[model samples]
Target: MFAMLVDFASPVSLDWLTLSVIPILFYYFVYTIYSLYFSPLANYPGPFFAKISSWPNFYHSTTGYRHIWIWQCHQKYGDAFRFKPDGVLFNSPSAYRTIYNSRANVKKGKFYEIWPRNTQNINTLTTIDKSAHGRKRRVLNSAFSEKAIRSAAGFVSEHVDRWNEVFLADNDGKEWTSPKNMSKMADYLVFDIMGDLCFGKSFELKEPGENEFRHMPHTIAEYMQFMYPASMITQSPMMKFWVWLKPRGLDSLFESMLPKNIRSYYEFVEANVARRQKEEEVLKRSDAEEGRGRNDLFHYLFNATDELGNPGYNTDELYAEANLLIIAGSDTTATTLVGFWFYITRNLRVYEKLVKEIRTAFDRAEDIQVGTTLSSCNYLQACIDEVLRAAPAGVADLVREVLPGGLEIEGGRLPEGTQLGVAQWSIMHHEESFGDPWTFRPERWIADSSTGVTPEDVARARSAFNPFTIGAGNCVGQKFAMEELLITVARTLWRMDARLVPGDNLGAGSSKLGWGSRDKNHIVLRDAWISIKDGPMVQFRKRVD
Candidate 1:
């Protein structure tokens, strides 16, 4: 009986356990072998798998510097290099054109998936569906048109006036350094404008330091950094769950999000939506008053119509889309202006030329209005462009998934679904693409054949200088952002005499975070000491006669 029992079941069951584990081990082993030596990426060079994976990004990108890795990759492997097994970093001007201006066949990749407000609301600004995105864009497109922007100039002017009164009034009539508060100042002004124009209410962030709205920028900065790691995971649909599973990156970012503060900003957006809706109701009653008094982007956008041939977005959709404006329009303007300040301060000669231009153009600081600054200040605009080239949100390297048909990048055929983009840093710094790529020469942008850059060169460089991106997925707020940057930077120059407060520079003090989709450096504040968060502190003696 015992022998029968053993032969029938017992020994066989033991073998089954071994059999089960055997396949699992074998599968893993094969996976390792494929990843190491035989996968599609095996030929492309990069740091070892462990370095390329999420761990280094999670650790280095968060606590200290993530940009260093990108710089290292380009240095080690030349322009076209592998960052991860699936992701390729194309660090050339040509590659940038290929990735950004891909044929209509290739749409925006899954990387932008997290840009939507939430699960329920996917608006035009964030949705990847081309037709849907196009439809949404059509309705909203009118407001951002050049004429519309000219009309909205006063809106920015009003905010700058409010900011000047709040900050400059505290100077006690002496050329003193009061905590180089440009970063915070820039934040308040940008957020306030974003709030009022989009939501129809000003947070008034530029007041005496204690304003609750002042912290909105910091809160945003925190949220932006916190989201990317989770955001990176979001692009990987299958790995989405990993973000919430106490991954170190997720944990840090989640902790940083600080619901109380983020909700304040969220509440502001929600409130702005409500206010905008009420205004739209009034607008319908009197779209007749037209350009008389009520001139905000809200009126135009809310009253817009979609391709489905109906009044565009509903209440919630309006709210979400407006917030996209907030996210896209606000900090970008502030950051660009802030970065512009950094660049100008470093190059005192550029600073003098810009200031001379602004001061010569407008006698008073407040007199330097948006439309006027935008129209005549070619040098100012060029300076702004150079800054964008030097420090773009899409600067590090943008990624695009090659569609099913594959891509011909720089004469090489990349397989479909292969992620690629031009390295903004590389392209902007390319000797061939930019002439003297490192030199901060604004005259290069002036329409002149004498400088060796013809209108064709200008067009080529302009195409290459896509700080706001290009083609379908380009930043819809580019015009608005440009207006803001030019206005704000011009005013700051006109009002103050700025310089690098002695030994310090404009780079980030701790780590440059919150550049949404770029690898930025030295972007912190530096007024008194060389710290990044403190911002530039110039001796503004109020440019008296």
Candidate 2:
């Protein structure tokens, strides 16, 4: 009787186990069917798993391979392809204009909100509201205007000279010395420049002793490493429970989950903002009494007024903008500088040509200033352009959402509420737009009658190049950033001779996509929101000539 009872119970347990898994299996079956045939994006071509879920793209993003994967997808699936269930990636230049420029109905997508800021208040970078972004941009434009950049040029030049001095002293009069990583040095120099511009103070990052903000760039990189995955999880229904539990004093739990570096970065910005506010009040009183005020970014923000005389950013907004400025103003310029050095060193011909142009243009390093003769060095400009094209700072998609009426793209009309963006890395490197796209050929940008590059080549390159992005919501600091690059690159190359240390992995490896995609031919970039670059271990010596 006991044995018969045990046999019956085993079958009952088996039935329970089978029933438990049925709902999960059914859900996956439904998801696969909808993703493959029944969904709105069913007609779009993409990896089957990508069509079914956002995880594949998210995983690539987390692994620092998002741009490479997108480029591969573009190669496999044509210009327009689905990268996520609700997202479409474009590789055509026209598609870039249509989505980002024609801002009639579309707006920045929900993906941007994943950037951690004040939950109640969004900054210019993360704001999805078009009108709000426009308003913020208008006020901020005063700080990034031509007059402001020109005013800041003296400050920028001073820092650039100081950086050269630091490098020289570090070498201790050696003919050539390998500083190991130019990337970290570039970060220090740019961070100091940003500190001066944003807070009216220099972090003195290039100086000897420990500086509090010296680790900021690394901290920001570390913080961004987890942000992509965290953002994905934050957007899901699971976050709803956290919100619901907030009233029960669970807010600290969420805050506790934030990385220590991110919190410190916020505190650093907050302190600076508070200090600047105090200084602004004093400056206002001083202006009333002595008729003088500073011209730094904080001063501009504090005094900025819209067309209607509306006050500029509030305290929290100031904090957000200041934080964004630190990252954008520093990291992008630093990344480009690092990539520029890597390419110029790897390609000796390009480096020699650039050095000749810069050296011929400026008799002395002091003469290389923004908006001066340095801008006329066409080859130098071409090298800068090539660097931006080859290794754009922002490697990932800059997504925008389709609005109520839907939107037209290169391939077809995207349905309403669909997210669309150009995969910059893919588009800039597209074979259809550029011949031998992977090659570091700055001559392609130069319209020399002798070089044999046709006007068509120049036109195609112009149409495809958008390192600072395009449209109404493009980078406000574009002019300033270009000026910084022009001055820094020209000055550094003029003062120092640079070459790669023998055995560094930075542009050295087997080719991947093409000859240009070789590990050794191009700077290997790791994307963590912004492209993080490592060693080309360049050795530098003071040029006697």
Candidate 3:
């Protein structure tokens, strides 16, 4: 009797287990069928698993190859392809303009909201609210005004001059310094400059010694790696729970999960903001305040007023805006500078043409200030444009979600709330838009008859090129970026000659990297929203007249 009772109980337990799992499996099977064959996005081509789940997109994002994956999908599936359940990417110039133009009926997707430190730390980049972003943007506009940028040129030149000195420091009177990783060097230089501009004092990360903040770049990169993937997760079908949890407990959980280095970075930013506020107060009280307070970018931000002529930002808002300025101002310029060195060092023709233009435009490096002569260097502009093309600061899509009433793009109407964007890497490399898109060609930007690049051809390229993006959400500090790039490239090339270390391709794509990143000539950038890259180790020597 006991043996018979035990046998019956075991079978009953087994039946219950089977009943629970079967329903789950059945539900998933039905959902997959609907997602692939019956949803509004059914016709969009994508990896089979990506259609069924968002895990594929999340996996690629965490691997830091999301950009290359999208490029590969575009190659196989044509211009428009689904990357996630509700996410579609378009790869054409017209599609880019249609989706991101000022008049577009779309707003930044929920992906942006994942960036702020908490609900209270909203800034220009993380805010999804249109009116709040507009207000914040108006305030930031004063921080990068023409007068402010002109004042900033002096600070930029000082930092660049000092950085050059450090590069040549232990040369031992040799023709060149030992091969320096341009990626690390550029980070140190740009971070120090951003420190000085955003705060009152420089971080001095480039000064070649013990510094508490030397690891800040690495901190920022790691932070981005985690956040970029998490942001993608929010756009998936599973995001319903995530969205519900964020306001309830997830924000605090995220803050707690921050690594020690990230916490240190936040502390550093907070300290700087406090110190700068104190100094601003003192400056406001001084009689010679007109020129007493240094006219750095921070000064402009501190003194800026709102539309109602009130202080533009309160304490919490200032901390948020100031932090964004440092990241945006520093990282973008550093990425471009590193990319410029990598490409120019590899391509001698581009290097020689650009150097000649800079040399001819200015008899002395000091004359390479931000003005008519500097702006007139067409070849210099072209080289910068090419670098931005080949290695954009942000390699991923500028994710935007359709607003109410839906929207039209590339001749197709996307339903409201669908997330879509033009992937920068895929669109810029579109063969139809740019002939020989993989090649590093700067002459394509010029309208010279000698190069057979006509005015129409140049216009066509311009239509596809959006280094700073365009319209309402365009980069506010574009002029500042251009000035800094112009100054850094011109001055560095003038004071020093540089070349890639023999057979050293630290930053170039290798066969081991797989498709869309196997070209030896192409600089490889890992996508973490803003690009993460390494180097083409280079050696530099002081230029001889």
Candidate 4:
């Protein structure tokens, strides 16, 4: 029987290879025709190549030019355009609201789930399950509340003070000292603050001596470099096989690919969470008899309970949240500071005006507290607003999937399973949204008639402004971020006079997309999921009143 089967197989020949190729070609032909002219999204204007394949979008994303590419497409295709066969990019403010509406049934797309925590448990940010996200959000809200932020304010100040000392010591009493890149300095400062808040201790990154976590920022950058391609890879048809083999094959592949420091970072968070849990256990035992305890972000998170007195988060969830807090809290605030310094230093007029505002607003640098006097510095706030507008930290798309019954957008109805979002870089720089959109003018946010900023201009800018985004899933640490920015900026400007290094165009507009430079500065930032800013070297000197 075996010999007979072999004899029969010999008669088939090599013609079957041609048979297999024909169906694949046919399928491609059918898909191209459908996606280009017969699909539900066929009417949407976009590059013909983009409408047929995901490769164009994926290629731009991997090269950190996704934001720039989308912005350019909007320039060609107008406010609404198809960015991928399965996705649409919107440039209008109303479109942003519609896509991210709290009442909408939309859910975060597959992209959010691509990056997994070491524990393999979904955290608030990565969770696509709406009900689970709601539960997590409820518990996490306590950690970022008004009282919680106020409690954490001292940590912010303490770290800032330490950073100042570190900066000055590095200067060695020179009248003018160039530390090169302000971006790394800001990262170290913010990392220390976030370390103290999230881990119940400081990483001491701003200390004079060697620190174990000094490479954290670089490690994070490396980790983010993996995210863009990984996200796109997970969206492919082969992802099913990848997921199936993830437990053994792909898991090891991912683990081996991670930078040593990235692995160490996760290990550090796990250890820190374990240490804090032990401390909380001791504190609970002592609290029953005595009253000795401390209040910080972890304290709030640990004690958070729902209406029924159930704990807000389990052990894995606690680990996940702690990991997220460090990354989100530190990276964003640090990036914003980097952009803020780049702009203000380059634009001497804005710098001098901000300096005057900071010096006049407080008699001493100590008076620059978070909510008290810092909030009153309108010019400082305007500078922050302008920085966020021109060079936002989260420059890429905050993607969401359209739900059943389909969703109504500005242009038309999008079918269910469609992924869409407003590319933040495009919306903020939309010509209709602001006058001289490419220019870094804080006056657009100031509403001053004499400065040529009309109330209408301010209103229009405000409508389009979504630095931290909006709605239910908006940044939980929004207030915390604002407080940190105001205090850090006001205190730094008050104590130091910063001048832009010669021949640096870090803050200048280098791209047709608007703010960041392609040369030295890259102030608008080169997007890699998280924006990567190079340098805006500034010489700093102690202010003499």
Identify the leading candidate in terms of lDDT. 3
Q: For candidate 1, write residues 72-161 as lDDT tens digits.
A: 566677776666656677666566666776253456666566544444467775576777777777777866877668767778878876
Residue 379's lDDT in candidate 2: 88
* Every model's TM-score: 0.83, 0.92, 0.96, 0.93
Residues 1-545, candidate 3, lDDT per residue (tens digit)? 87865664597878988899999999998998898998778888988888888899889999999899999999999999888777789998898899888889999998887788777788898888888889989999999898898888998999999988998998742488888988889989988888888987788999988998889998898888888998888888667577667778988998898788788888988999999988898878775547777888878888999999999988898999889888888889999998999999989988888888888788887777988888889889888888889888988898999999999877678888888998888878878877888989999998899899999988888889998888778899888898899899999998888999999979898999889898999999999998898987999988865
On TM-score, the candidate that comes out on top is: 3
Tens-place lDDT per residue, model 4, 1-545, is 87765553553644666678899999989999998988889989999898988888878877776788888899899988987788888999899989887887588888876666443656889887888888889899987888889888888887887677666775664577755578888888988888889877888777767877899988888778767777876555436354455665666788888777877887888898999988887888766543255567888898898768899988888888888888888878988998888878767888889899899989888877876577778888998999888888888888898889999888598999888899888888888888677777988888776898888888998989998888778899988998899888888778887788887764445645542334333355667778777667777778866
Compared with the true structure, model 1 gives a TM-score of 0.83
- lDDT of every predicted structure (CA atoms): 0.65, 0.79, 0.87, 0.81
Which residue pairs clash in candidate 2?
Answer: 507-519, 507-520, 508-519, 508-520, 509-520
Name the TM-score of candidate 2: 0.92
Indicate the worst ten consecutive residues by lDDT in candidate 1: 524-533
> What lDDT tens digits, residue by residue, belong to model 2 across residues 148-181?
8887788889999898877778666457774547
On lDDT, the stronger of 1 and 4 is: 4
Ten residues in sequence with the least summed lDDT for candidate 3: 2-11
Q: lDDT score, residue 36, model 3?
A: 91
- In candidate 1, stretches whose alpha carbon ends up further than 4 angstroms from where it belongs are 1-25, 50-64, 102-104, 115-117, 235-238, 241-258, 286-288, 370-374, 435-439, 447-463, 505-534
RMSD to truth, every model: 6.5, 3.4, 2.4, 3.5
